[model samples]
Target: MRKWVFLCLLFLPFLSLAAEREIRIGLIDTFDQDFYLETFVPTIEHIQKTLKDYKITVIELQQHNLLANVVKERPDFLVSSAGNFVTLISKLGAQQIATVSRNHAYSPKEAVSSVFIVRNDRKDLQKITDLKGRVLSATEPHDFDGMLVGMGEIAARGFDPDTFFSKTLFSHYQYPDVATYVKVGAADVGILGTCQYEKLLTTGQIQPGEFRVLEAKNNTEACIRSTERYPDTVFYALDTAPIDEVKAVSLSLLSMPKGEFDFEWVPASGFLKVYDLMKSLKLGPYEHLRETTVKDFILSHQKELLLAALLLCAILVHVVRVNWLVNRRTEELKFALAVQRATERKARENRQKLDLLEKSRVISQMSSIFAHEVKQPITNLIYYASALSLLLQQLGVKDDRVEYALKQMNSQAKRTSDIVEHVRSYAKHKANRSEVFNLVEVIRRAINSINKEEIEGVQTTANLPQEAIAVGDSFEIELAVLNVLKNALKAAKNSLNPQTSVSVTAQKHMWKITITDNGPKISEEIFSALGRPTSTSKKDGLGVGLSIVLSIIENNGGHLTFRRIEPNGIAVDLFVKKKEE
Candidate 1:
């Protein structure tokens, strides 16, 4: 037993050593090893600092033959363009650790893009399809953003990118060279990447509006791109890479600051957009989708297709049954709707008849009230007229009595006329037409209409603004205010020290007429029945005042409310819509 335990302990060190993964990073060759290394020096230094114990080695691989070398070497980390990363991910289950950010561009997830350019003088090529049979000048064909991305855009628009252009011209990785070719009329259209045209304009090699963009994407304001953006260069982790080591590298890259490259390292974004583009152009991971045979697809999807066929049959049966049920229900609902509409029509006619009967009752009641009320005024006017006639017969005896008699007769005549007009309007139950009237003036008229002796003998105060414009029927508002003031005066008459105050205030969207008095607290029954017809606290009350006030105010987008004052008082708030300043 001791011997076996010793052997097991001795192999533990070897097992730990075998578990450790190699920290090797593969960098796709861009310009040269030195240039690429310098560009990503900050990232390299950061990784070295983070994984101090591990020996990190970066290998530069040629872009054209990276796939073979990548599979053979099985690199733990691969820093390459999004297209290469996507290919590696598809082939070897590679996962991107971080995306490279760029200066003066969209986020790292949506930075790489390509554009189609033409000289401003090329009026013949107004659109992208115009360059279909024309010569296309572009940078290196192997370059992802400069050439391949533009080709993907063409494919996405349903064009065969392989045969879209009659002839192709290469500018050999110089983005500006393609623009130069277009400017010199060597090619009908040129393709560029990474705002090369805008850079040239900044260098004064191209003027504003000197080149036109074809099928330009408004995806960004930083550059004019013809194609949708994919993610920026990514730091990727292979399937064989150790999870702990990959996490360390990711942390180091993300924490690194922008150095000479003027770009930052950020967490990798989803590459579904890149995958979709590659699928459309038959590139990268989706290359096999284009190569699959029809027979292979049928064999692989036979079960799904069979299930789909069964589902379709079941769906057809369900649809037929549902259609029959819906038709029958629709007919039954139609009959019910017809019966309901007929019932509604009968109810509406009955309502009209009720309204007519109510109006007739109002007319008869108002006629009787008018006749009873106008008799006193008419009798007084006759007496005053007889007195005036007597005074006129006695000539030269000019006294104040003659003038008094004439004024009394005129006053009683006016009263009689007002009563007649009011009863007619009340019996008809016709609403007054609304208009913009000064509320200050309406309140003044209401206060003046009361008996002068009663108002002066009591402690009544009127505080109103100089101008308060309201929107409502002026006559209705005046009547409402007058009736309320009359009630307040009557209630305060018997008080030891009667106090009544009428004030008009202008609110944001409403004109408020507040009538308050030191009278008895309103009864709950009277308060509840407020604004309702045939409800009154006074023995001789007609109950028309508050109802008319509420109805008119409500109809004109206003409100009426009553609040009980502390101790022993009642406050009335009449709100009407104030004209906007």
Candidate 2:
């Protein structure tokens, strides 16, 4: 009887020490009531079963109220998703110790991904790069695990999540709203969490295969994640919490059973994954988030913090001033280098112009000599051919030879005319002169100058407007027109024997004049040569006519083109931009 009484007295204090102290677990209401009833209850039951030694009570509250109650209830532990965990830890001085990885028939983690959901029919969305500059719908920007991790994956591939997306919206009130925004096409791409997408599919809010992932980045860890797997729901230690208790909880989470739906607890680095992501993606705290209003700055920084910030700003200004001087000197050097480059460019251009002028002068002098020398011979040939034609007519020759002789005489006269025209074109002056003149009237005059005899064997037509006008040297324009007309006549004479025609058409548009011609087809090789200073015809050619034409046209801000007229002919087009009107 004495031994039993002594044992009972010794165990009395121990029994009082074992009496249950309250251990409240705060759960953020990230899910709706249905999910809380179905998923949360079972999960809480398991937690309670595992922590049987303490009087554990799980209190579910909305994220808005989680912080308030943390001060009121002072929970011994907190449980939330990776995103809510960040806010709770930051605001309530609570910590996250474990994260649940769900793997079930409803969601196969092995095939899970952060889906960049777009319309299945959009071919432009073949790659992630195509999503740049497109509007996106997502969760809140602060929801690191939900939107930011996926956004970081996009940024890693060279797209600026903030800028590449033309607009960003947080339409999801919580996890369930993602499917509605995507299904309605409110955005080009809707970013959603893996489990959230499953939930959406299960609820019939979204259809499978209706959306295709634009750019999928896979993460290992049994889930075919579309984004890098962030260290989820990291556990943080309260400043006042016993370090031993925190360590004990962390060890328990790590030592949990290895299974597909297992939860893992690792040491809480307080959203280090998010911090790293922000740094890599150049977003959030890692980026310089500009405070647009003074109120915004004040709300972000308290009075003491603001004072520290002001001192920091002063130091930053000093550093910035020093950097500014360095940059200014560097820019001055750059400007000097740019000026030197400009001088070199000007020198090169001037040299090229001088060389072109020298060549033009040499060609001009040679052409004058050739024209003067050839004029007498051409005149003699014309006279002799005319004399022969008259003799053949007087003989009344029925022979084919007589007819052939007359034909030869006509050809010789045409050759003489061509040479005279070339000489005249080259001899025309090309001086810088600006004057407003009717472009239509100038073209009509040039077409009229096309001799009737040249068009005798072929039909010729002209189409031109009556009121089109331009500002430039009229003399140069006239010379260029004549050269083009002469070339057209020559081309028409080649393939078609007496029935071929050349058509001249002019069109006017705002600040433009277009003259098109139809003649015998010319190859690109020959056409390219036509405007070259040294280019020429195959027979009896000096090559200066078209050269002079190009020179004059270019000086007046015009371009010349000789292209094939489809199957069998050529068209010479002259496009001039009117200087004034």
Candidate 3:
């Protein structure tokens, strides 16, 4: 009985806390301070000291997920890291009331930055490109402000961090790891937080003279030290958040105690700049969501408008005069038919042009692959011919043996020549044509033609059925599938090692075949671009591969879609209707 009573007494504080009106404050996990004592507990302590009416709870989230969770939580207020706050204000309509300057390195005008560092002894490392194919070390992959921006600076200097870097080594342990990774030669280049590196050098944890900073211009934003300064945290409520609560919370944060923590509240920043950044960088989820929402709205309204117009025409036709109405109806029907035909014809022509453009884009992307593929066969031909010439120059060479050797060498050269021609022909044929052929067989032939021996950088596996057939231009389907396969292959190859493989699985159901890939995912921007001619990646692609694929599928009464895989990668589902039994 005594034990039960004690347990009930212990639960009283939790019950009272739960009963109070909840005010959520979002925090980022990047803040190294202990939340139990620093932000959350202190804030709650302040609330108890100041506001007697409400109960406030602090929720810590990563920088990337913080804004999204805030939108979901519909938080009354948010108190997050300075850098993350800037990101929110720039992208979302979040406002800032107070900025908490960490006493360690916080100042009125200085901000922290992750600087690029490399070993001083390494040769051939003057420019950014010198770090190509070298191991890059970062504290965390998703440390956007710390690592991403620093890398972006490198990319701005003409080296694409994603493709140019050979290996990425992530050490989430902080400055010590960054210094150690560089000192021990584990990483070719290391990114370190501004003060962290200085602290390490001061503490004798790392030798300052052992590392060199890449010569680049630097700037400051808010208090953050950045190569290219981005604004510090701003607090504001989003569209769905309650304004009164936000204002109240903002006021509360501004009135916070100075003894425990030194921070000030400021007005919320505009997202137009952030939107512009997103457009410029093509990073983040906002622009893609906006685009998807707009497209969906347009499509839905178009369908409704068409249906309503058709209904109005049918209902109003009975009120007009008989002969006059007949002539008017005839003209109207002709006009409608003509419009329909014109729309379809334009769509078809646009699709054809898109196809040709995609083929060229794919060819351009695979130039290195082509060069790599051609090198071996050409090298073999040269080596063998040189050996044959040397053999002929030897004394007492039999005529019959010489003839046989010549015949063999000629056959090998012709085979190599044929491989080159096949690759060239596939890339060169851009015109659209409609001729029925076995789609399954065409896929097999494409697989066979993949130059598996010469270009071993990509691994491709296709699970196509033996007897599946569809009546469409075989060449077009081959090209479309080839492009997708190549894309998947490249994505895998780029992100991972050269041994990465792309799996293509074809699922045949009642009148449909779905081709899927287990490769790096297609983002929303690329997925939403299906059948649209204007979408493209910056790799000089005309955004025509899927457009042409969609066109071909539509022509054959089929559909193409990009489905998101749960764990990773993307499934480029090409739904083609089966021929009649």
Candidate 4:
């Protein structure tokens, strides 16, 4: 007894909870409200019998008051036709819990369909198309079985359901009214839901031979239908419904015996067919789409709009990327140009130094030539003066004017001789082969001379090989190398990142000294007349430095040549007779 009491206590709260649970179910009042209780009371009683402790409330939903009542009454579940269920599911977040199958006559999904009815004697209605332009009796277009099914068939045949019939009597689309109207000749043709004809015959309200189904379609149903079948009615829940209680209600409805009622609950079937029907007719959930608006336009042209947006984004990205690349390249080009200008400036400075060197060399050459020539002439004059003085003394023909003239001539000749000697001493270098020195050391001297000017920003590189002995005057070699280096540096300075390079490579019979520069290419005229006095790049140049350098090198058993460097530069090669070890 104590154990029994404990068990009861444990179960007591659940029973009380069940008793306190109040459920409200909304029913779409598509049927006549007068017969609403008779039509739905059995189903409600079946539910009440299952949940004996729970209180269930019923709410009738008129078509005009569907959304408003659903919001105000807040029903836990909804029972309605498939079309009304679709509307509620879309607008109120309702989900199908079970489908209604009438008397186990058809599957839940393919339960109801429409049929065309005509009198037996109406031979004129041999086919559905024959009824075109004839009178049609049906409910509103929204009625799934009464009208939409048959209209859907007409539409499937590519006929406009609205215009296929010349005239139509529209109403609530009650099946019996359609049948009676057809029988009485009030309507030439009629539309009915699946199995309504059999029902009418069972009630003896119509004779079998009195009517004939037009174009009956063979399907897996107990009733003859002229159109494809769609799901019948559905039981669904709103967002506010308790899932556990809703499931209990579903189980109860499914378990309801196929008693006196025309319908029973079954497992939920696919409602997509109904949605398709609505789409074909442009009714129900698709009704708003008939109006023209931006939202509707977007919904209709969703793919096109999405593709256009993507293409636009791609173009924007491509443009942005291209612009960024162009900016980067422009900046790079600017930097490169600035560097080039700077290098060219430095080159000009070096060329100025070379020009100065050329001027000094030419002036020294002229002075040496003048001194050599005048030295002999002045000595001859002095000798002549001495001879005249001696002859006058011997002949005893002495005069004060002649003596003064001789003295002046002698003094002037001596003074001129001294000036010539000074110039000759300054211009000449007495280099002999006995002074055997390293050719590399001679190049070092030439570089040292160039460094005296402290030239900046000109890169000079020299490759010195092992003991490149050359049989020549070191001084002349040094001078020649120095001249070549100056020329290279001058040319190289005209470029960005100026480079002047000297390389010495020794052979068995000769040693090669090559100097290269990265500068403007040598002109053909300048190259052809190289090592000769010709037109030079300098405004005041007589091309004397390189000429003197060539002369000196030839005098020392060596020769030099100038050639162009590929791309933009010049190179000089000096082949000196090597003093072999």
TM-score of each: 0.45, 0.39, 0.40, 0.45
Could you give me the TM-score of model 4 versus the true structure?
A: 0.45
Better of 1 and 4 by lDDT: 4
**Alpha carbon lDDT at 142, candidate 1:** 59
Error of 4 at 97 (Å): 1.2
Better of 2 and 3 by TM-score: 3
Clash counts for the predictions, in order: 0, 7, 16, 2
Supply candidate 2's per-residue lDDT for 49: 62
lDDT of 4 by residue, 1-581 (tens): 99999999999999888765988988876643322564477888889899876799988877775688779888899888788888777788888888867664557788778889999889889888888899888866556667777888887888877689888876564554777788878788988776777877989988879888888876656778888878877788887888887878888887988766567777766688888877777677877757768888999999999999999999999999999999999999999999999999999978966976787687788979999888898999999999999999999998999999999999878867865765575488543354567888888878876774534678888889767767777766776788788878877888988998999987668888999999887678667778865556788666667877786777777788887886689889998887766
Q: Rate the local accuracy (lDDT) of all candidates.
A: 0.78, 0.62, 0.60, 0.79
The most accurate candidate by lDDT is: 4
Candidate 2 vs. true structure, TM-score: 0.39
Give, for candidate 1, the lowest lDDT window spanning 10 residues: 30-39
- Residue 476, model 3: lDDT of 55
lDDT of 3 by residue, 1-581 (tens): 99999999999998886665566665555543333455556655665566556666666666556656766666655654444544565567555565444554334233445667788877667766677788888777655445755666665666655666788777776555766887788888877664556666778877757777765444332222335543334444454456655666767767776655544443433434434433343455343533447677778799788899899887667555666878999999999999999999999989877876776576555743795688677768857886776687685466887767777776667656654544454455433445656677776665665666434665555555556656555665665666666655655554454322323344453224444445555667766656566646548776655665666566555677776664356667665555565
In candidate 3, where is summed lDDT lowest over 10 consecutive residues?
A: 217-226
Q: Which ten residues in a row have the lowest lDDT in candidate 4?
A: 30-39
